[model samples]
Target chain A: MNLHGTPLSIVIFALFVAAVLFLSFFFARKAKSAAGYYAAGGQIHWAVNGISFAGDYLSAASFLGICGMIATLGYDGFLYSIGYLAGWVVALFVVAEPMKRMGKFTFTDALDAKFDSRGIKLAAAISTLVVSICYLIPQMNGAGSLVEPLLGLPHWVGVILVGAIVIVIVSAAGMTSTTYVQFLKGGLLLIFSTILVGFVLSRGLSTEPVGLESGAPRGEMTVQATDSQLLEQGYALLHTTGSLQKYVRDGTTTWWKREADGTLWRAQWTSDGVVNGVAGGVLEPVGRLRQIGGMSEAEAAAGTGSVGPLDFLAHLTHPETRIEQWQKQAVTDEKGAKYAVYTPKMVSGTDQMKPGVKFKVHTTTEKLNFVSLMMALFFGTAALPHILIRYYTVPSPACARKSTIVAIASIGFFYVLTLFMGLGAAVNGTVNPADNNMSAPLLAMSFGGVLFAIISAIAFATVLGTVAGLIVAASGAVAHDLMDRFGRMDLSDRQKVRAGKIAAFAVGIVAIVLGIVFRGVNVSFLVGWAFAVAASANLPAILMLLFWPRTTAAGIVASIIVGIVSSLGIILTGPEMFAGPYGLTAEQAWHPLGQPGIISIPLSFLALIVVSLVTKNRRVAVEA
Target chain B: MLHGPARSSGPDPASGYKTRLGVVMFIIYCVVYAGFVMTNVVNEGRAMQTIVFAGLNLAVVYGFGLIIFALVLALIYNHLCTRKERELNVTRSEKGAGA
Candidate 1:
């Protein structure tokens, strides 16, 4: 999976980064006032804002994390995609137009729009920074992962590089630069992903170095097809001594080993040469598809040469098709040795297309995790500080609605493409199970080096765009919501812009440190935590402020505080954060599930309602 | 210290229609989405994963169906909301002329 700074990919990545910097400085000339810096003078076209929304939403987690999951874990990965896109529906229908009508700049502007209360502003602003920082961790983590393979640099270098670049991008022109960068990256990601999926369909299925249907019982006799006979009896020896000698017999290398069960197995024969980006002659054609299941009698005889997109799916669901599936388990030997091992099984495509492969749904607690994660995704989109602020960038309420629809279309298309990209990686041998974040880019490499380079570059920009958006939101919370409103700085527009710039740099530095601190975690998994916190803290206030007339400012403030505290508290004490942060075994972690939304989201709403009711009479007394 | 509900705030029909439409669309969306989540909860994904359409499993197709279905609803709501906003503007201009 390590490209090791392949010259072509590195060049492409550098050029793309350079282009992003140029765009930032180019737009810097237009960022004059606080309004222009924070919200692009509220003049962006709905279409541009819509595409930027797609760019911002489709973070490294979307492209890299989901693809890696799909590659390694089949349909379980698509669950994330479905949950993410479903969240957009809430954004478009419930939050978009109303947010535009209400807010001027930061997300707190929307919350404080009616009451103009300092308590509300402080609470919501703090929520913004908390959610933004949690979200920033994943983005920076993605950046670090990309750096090792793409730039041949240390993980910290990648984190610092992206953190510095994003700080400059936000400080230079604020949202204007971030929007254009997102627009460019989003459009490129979609178009390139489509092209990659097209290549997958054109170079259909194959079984190079094929085994006895892949999942034959290890150390047991099974029927393997050889040309000399219709079917020959053989066995698989996964582990052997002497570094395994390779023989070039009949253009296929065979490895021999003595199994404890006393059976002989031969490795599948190889077809020397390259066909449609698949290279042979080498033992591991990492980019070439080595196995597939479910074919007609004649099709099996012919070897599925190439098929259309529909045919690919048809072959996938044929009930006979077996996909290459991998399972990882942590094991301890009788001698007390512990290590994680991966076993690859040829799974039925039907099973691969189902829900319970990676994230199980059998146990009640597991189901709770699934539902909570989905809730976080659903309510989190509208409440995300960066996404809410985008509603302000457009001109009118209708424009906000229109832009959201456009973002939905673009995002939906990309999610569909992720299915193909991930599936293609699964069968094509491009999946790096150790690091799922590398799956999409490595899948691109399986096709061609140029495709790999381009995808990795865009993936880098994907990180930058999302990071800038998050930092801009954080900086806005700091400068406008906290300092200007609550601190009563009463600064001029020019001074406000300067304060925002300085805040952006500081937030960017903090993100770099956190990104370096939390390495090797899946970006998408980290993002789920952010969403849970955002849904818990920010969503109840926004939803009630717009719909419930009796929603007192005290309720909004209390909800924000409770939501942020309880959700974040659960995450920090959860299993995922236990091993490193708390120096405890995951079994010792207190939270039952990693996702806190199922509990925290309802609690926020309850807090808002109860506080509002009790405080309503107090408000009346004040009015008298 | 508080603004009243949309209905109580002088009966602006555009805002009123928007509020109603928002509620209905949200309810419909919740039902459809909750059906997907609850299917997994109830059957643990066994019931919906049956092969129903185009030889694809219901879980796969239904998951995708939810995504595209959301876009279609958004487009429809946008069209209706735009028309209502225009109607409200025209009514206001006519009143201005009469005054």
Candidate 2:
């Protein structure tokens, strides 16, 4: 759906960008030293650092993608929220303290803190670069999408705008500026989402929702007509396959499903406002209730006046409540021209609240894929390069632990709100079936235009905060690990900060290009792959280094290399990638698993052990 | 030439206690999380649809439970570790000052 840029949204977006730039410039003076640039001088209070973690982690994917997924697929999206928040458990329990005590600047520093080997530095730095770049693609893409509705600009313009703004943020002050921006964004996101959920609760559930009446306009004309009558009104029969017939008139396509009695029922896009032979208004905006608590149609029209949080979920999940769900089907005409058409089906509230709708886990491969995704999400948190680097921004191991706890409390609360916001959008007739990404924004618009503007601006800030964090991680990899440590350049602190700034600019440009190039791909899928890569590559190395005393420099290097190669190899050849950019059938792909974590994670651990044993014996022989 | 300068050489006094506590908490979470994934996988979410508690199905109840549980565990873990660090490290520091 094409979204128009309102004057209010533009003003809010401009103010948000202006504040971010102002923060960047303000902090520039303090970031002249390498330590200050990379880690905010390791003096950020635990509370601010904690919320910044949430800001950095809750990328566009968490807000837009999860809300969109939940808005459409129900419980499946919350599965992501659960997995994502669970990953922090690993971060707090396993990686947080050790990473803080050991590392000085970047993720590589923590890994090489013990062995200090050039090989570990090089391997870890390269992995950080690769992972950061992969993660950057989705954030950049989300920025572009947001810009279209906010500023009425093209996607590339949005990509370039975010890129330029983030480059300035990273180069000007680095972590200091990045932290404050994230803290602000994280705080606003939580506050406004709570307010929006309040609006949802106040408005409550309604069977006969006002705005888009059952996705069809109210009191519109309708008449049952024969096939002859439909054709007489200039509806061309596009194709007839099985019980479904496709038709087109004036570039508007519609579907007709034949009933058992041989009568045809039509479902078409409502915006076209085409009604001939079919009803004039039956194809309305969807996502309203058919019935609540077994009420009659007349009684249900009264709607639930207002509900508390628990009451909303209880009523929505009642078995007697029927929700209008829109399912999209890919249809092809006689000419083989293909497009998607939405058809409405009534689903029980209980069924919508369950898991089977999105992920069909009956097949063994599908079940394994589901489990693999959860594993990646569970282990992926502590291993993420950006998240790992956040540890160094705190003063001590104790502070790291405390900050992680703060992050968990705030993020968990916000995730619970996602369920309400998503269901609110689902039942309020606000979800745009064509692009579920617009669900949250549209839901906000349902409350009022001002709330919509603030939410959009916050969503835009969400993108900026995450992208800046990624760039900071990527640049630290280049300047600190690769250039200074691995290459042994021995640069001064001033020169090191300058190198990082330059690297930030270079990485930002690359992110912008990739974002525009991969515009139409699913943002969540890319993010999932990033997590898988992080879990497979970084987790094993970090874990073994901290816990395993015999872990050698060679082992860490070997594990990092194996982790990066295996995960990337699997993902590039996996089913999703094959079905997507490669333009091939999913079954034709080499890999069976959609996620690489289950296999690659273990492979990395094994590589570390085997390499360490062999290297240990070799060192003994050399000494003799 | 293979080794770079290490930041700190001696083992930390609180390291042993903290690692043990962290590992235990990590294992507990992993087991609970695995159960959630397995429940959906085994019966094709049939178990998830069954109303488990509070008039909510097993899916809604368990999914929200996992999120809230993680935070609670985190808070508990942080509190315990902080207490241990104070108890263990303060004694070591006092001994060091005497030496």
Candidate 3:
């Protein structure tokens, strides 16, 4: 469902963004001190801070990616939500009060609290930047993806816009502005999502899903020798037009054409008037009913024979169910013809299982890699520099605890509503098969133009809120952790605050550039890497400091370094990164797998213990 | 100074009662965690399985986890609050005697 650029949505979105910016500027005046810039002068109300936690926590990936995944993959997408919420458990029980007590500013404050070690400060700062950048890439990308459809701007322009606005917000008031922005966005996100979910349930499950097409179906045709040797030998001219868009030498391509009336149809490649199969046979476009075993009454009642409500729900929740949807082409030739491929994969069930179901196949095996990725997200929340720093914005540790509980309630309710909204998108048949990021927007389109506009605008605010928070966190690390803490710069409060604002601008620009560069990758997938890195590099250190008596400064420093290196090394050298970008074959990648949480987390813990023990007596004598 | 007063009431039976409560809550948490894991494994990670008691499954799994978390937090807070109360009482009585 393509949005018609409705005036209502534009106005709503404009007002929302303008209000956020205005509020940020208002707060900027109040944030002259370093304390105000980095920690909101320790004056934000617990309730507001709690909601801001939801706002900061629920990024574009959570709202759009997870919702889209649920729309396409079913229960698997919800796994992200569950995993995300579960991480708060770690935050509430293990990290909250202590983090507030230990750290004065950034996550590095807590890590370097016991040691006062420069190594720990530097390592933690670097990890914070890396994870923040990784996390920023997806948010920026989501911003671009959102803008292209909403404002009809180029992807790069969207990235720049989000980057600029977020920088302005961060630079203006730092955490003070960021927190309020987040609180506003978080409240709006929940409120709007609740409204959207209400609309979804009212629509209910239809017998036949209706009105999903938004473009023309063009047939593209391509021919290449099936022989791998021949394909590698030379350039192969492949004819691709109509439904069979392109025949590629190396990869499979797929495409959909929109009819004049906006009825979207899939283009089928045919030989002898039959669709071509891998085995050289005709393939036909199977109607929805035939694909899911002739629709039942539930499907009929919904006026769509494609998929029944129960069946659709079942397919989503079932781990073994393989659902097919169109995805954008990864690589295309110089021709204007876009390439698409049809790939089949099993659904993820990890989202459906409650936390502590770690032993399930979904949680344990490589097939359920997304689950493992989510496990990192779940645990990573407490360790996030941005989030941990937010704890310090409150005056007392008790207030920190109170704020977390409030955040839990707010965040939890929103996640529950996401299920309804996602499932609604699935049955509404308004999903953008090519881009899951547009699921909520498209679902809003199903309701009406105004609803679509409102939801889309709200989603834009979501990006703004999160990006502001991240920029604030990154700025704090640079100005406070690096300069003041390590560099021994004797800057006044005003200078520190000014330096932080400058850092925020620089980080914002970098985020925008990275966002534009990584457009094709799934936002949620990218976020998973961020979570893994955060969990690996930060969680172990935090846990050890809070729980262990023997944790010394040297130990903390060593653990931070080991955790950062091992996680980054594993990710960079892992099959996914090396094979995709580094021009290395999958086999040539050094790591056995992509995820490093399972290994790096443990390694960090061990490194801390061993190093702390070895250096314990040495440190004692020095202090004496 | 804080510990000196707390030492007088430290051996109260209430401590034993609280420990038992802690043990029970811990066991409940373990059971709920195990049951959730078992459900996922047995169902092979399928959704919407009609377990015998209908809504009971959701109630048990979600309720148990939440209750455990809440209980743990409450226990910790209670312990801290009581200690503070005792300290405040001791400090007030000492001031009264000096007056």
Candidate 4:
């Protein structure tokens, strides 16, 4: 897709940034004390805090990444939605009230509440910093990419700009400004997504592709030719004959499918430089509805106008409905130059509603990987330092519980909308084959330019809100937990708040550098790694501390250290990293599994148990 | 009895009751979530495609059900816990008045 920011988009985005900065400066006076700076003076209303939770938690990954995944891969994307929501069950039920009651400012305070051991303080602080940094990398990188197509800026400029803005937001009024910013972002995101989904349901489905939906004529045609005939025509066959075939000639790669009559029907990429399709006259856009509820192209176009929620889902789930999914192919030309092409594959609606499209459960390793990822996502939320610190932002444990309930309601509602938005992108000719992350925004574009601008601005604000939260968590770790507690700096209240501001600046700079350095890395993958690390390193210790009376200080420390080291070690040495960033073959990696939560989480629990048992004689203050 | 200053010296009486209820709720949710994961794993997601309700497949129904169920459960838990906290505080205040 050729995307250049319209003048209208730039104005809206600038207004959004200005509004956020205004809020920061407005709230600056309220953050005079350390508590005010770190936890918004613990005076946030449960309702506002709840929405802020959604804003803080739903990063660019949830808005762009999941919608993109769902648009491309179907129901497998919703699996992320399910796992992420399930995690809140842990957060609300197990962690929220206890964390609020025990901690004053940071997650480390809660973990070290029972035991005043410096080891616990140091270990928890390190874990917080590690997880916060890992999570920040993806949010920062998402900012850069969102700015590129939304503002027409370069990658580095976007990263630095987001970093500077977030630092100001965090330093100016700390949690007070951050919370309001997130609340605004959350409200706008929900309102706009609901509107977009309403638009989608009203439009319904169409059998015709881009021309009917997007007003762009599709380019496709079928030429009857055998494999040998194609070879005679100077086309080099790349792969063949399942539902799709691939061939490359000159600088263009063409896609083919075998017809029932033993002939090949091909679609070629045009010379428009935007990955448009042009091959004879039968080709269409990369993604569209082929048939809806068994209706043919012309029939469905005339019949299926405007549908309700259940009716829309029912039509999509019909066995006769077929949605065109674009499968991307990475192929090399005759001179070995790499090129990406998309092939249209017609998938049955039933299969589209199933889980096998993206995550395959056929092999033993695949099953383990799927299970591991689910485990990470399910256990990760409560363990995250940013999420944990939010508990302290409320006045009482009951307020924390209420805030969490609100968060679950709003966030859960948003996840449900993602299903419709993703499916809308798929069948409405809005999927960008080159960058799946653009699916939701492009779908808004299909509605209107104004809607697109508003959605893009909300998406960018989503990055800002999440990044501000991360920097706060990292700063709290450095200033409150490590320097104040572990190092016994005995900082005054003013000094502590000033130290936190300085730390926020430092973390923001680091995030900016890392975001630019990892420019092309997938944001979702980085987020998944952060979840694995958080679940492994923090969840076990927190759970045991809350439940197990025999849990000693040494046990918590060991569990955290082991959790961090093991998960990071496995992820760094795993096959995926080896193949992707390390420039080595997957076989060269020592580790087999890509996800670490399955093993590391259990190992962390085991370590805590064994160490606590061994140190039972010297246990720290046991709960009465 | 402790090494350093803490927010409180010992666990409050109400926390024990709340913790028990929270743990039970967590385990209940875990069982259902684990079942969803196992269904996808054991049969290559074939069971997920079975039509369960309202012409929707099991995957969509179950996925949407999980999201809604979480919110419902959270609201229920909050209501129950809030009532319990109020009851305990009222009793404690009454006893203090008598003393």
Top TM-score hit? 4
Candidate 4, residues A1-624: lDDT per residue as tens digits? 345688999999999999999999999998998888999988899999999999999999899989988998999999999999899999999999888877888988888888888999999999998998889998899899999988999989999999999999999999999999999999999999999999888877776533233533222322457788878988888764355567877755676766666677654443334343343222243466778876776888665778888788888888888887777665554555454555666788999989998789899988998999999999998899998888878777888899999999999999999999999888877776656787888888877788989999999999999999999999999998988899999899899999999999999999999999989875567788889989999999999998888899999998999999999999999988998888889999996789999999999999999998998898977673
Query: How many backbone clashes does every candidate have?
Result: 4, 5, 37, 4
TM, every model:
0.87, 0.92, 0.77, 0.93
Q: Per-residue CA lDDT of candidate 2, range A367-436, in tens?
A: 9888888999999888999988888787777888899999999888889988998898888877766667
Go through the candidates in order and give each one's DockQ: 0.37, 0.51, 0.12, 0.52
lDDT of 3 at A54: 92
* Top DockQ hit: 4
lDDT of 3 by residue, A295-368 (tens): 35554445433333343344333333223333333324355433343322222332332222322354344534
Instruction: Output the TM-score of candidate 3.
Output: 0.77
Cα lDDT tens digits, model 1, A1-624, are: 236677998899888889899999999976777877888877889999999999999999899989988887778899889889989988987888777766778888878877778998899888898888878998998898888778889999999999999998999999889889889898898899999898777767654323213331111222223323311323222333332212234343244322334433233222224311235322222222323555554555455766776566656655677665644444433345342433345567677777788767888878998898889999998899998899878777777889999999999989988988888777766665456667787767767678888989899989998998999999999998898888888888799899999999999999999999888654455688778888999999988887788888899988998898888888778887785466678888886677788889999999999999989964422110
* iRMSD of prediction 2: 3.2
Backbone-clash count (model 1): 4
Please give, for residues B1-99, the per-residue lDDT of candidate 4 as tens digits: 112212222334577788888999999899989988999998798998888887899999989988988988898898889888888888988998999
Give the C-alpha miss distance for residue A277 in model 4, angstroms.
11
How does residue A144 of candidate 4 score in lDDT?
A: 90
Off by over 4 Å in 3: A209-299, A302-338, A342-371, A521-523, A582-588, A620-624, B1-99
The 10-residue segment with the lowest total lDDT in model 1 chain A: A215-224
Candidate lDDT scores, in order, read 0.77, 0.83, 0.66, 0.85
Candidate 3 DockQ, CA atoms: 0.12
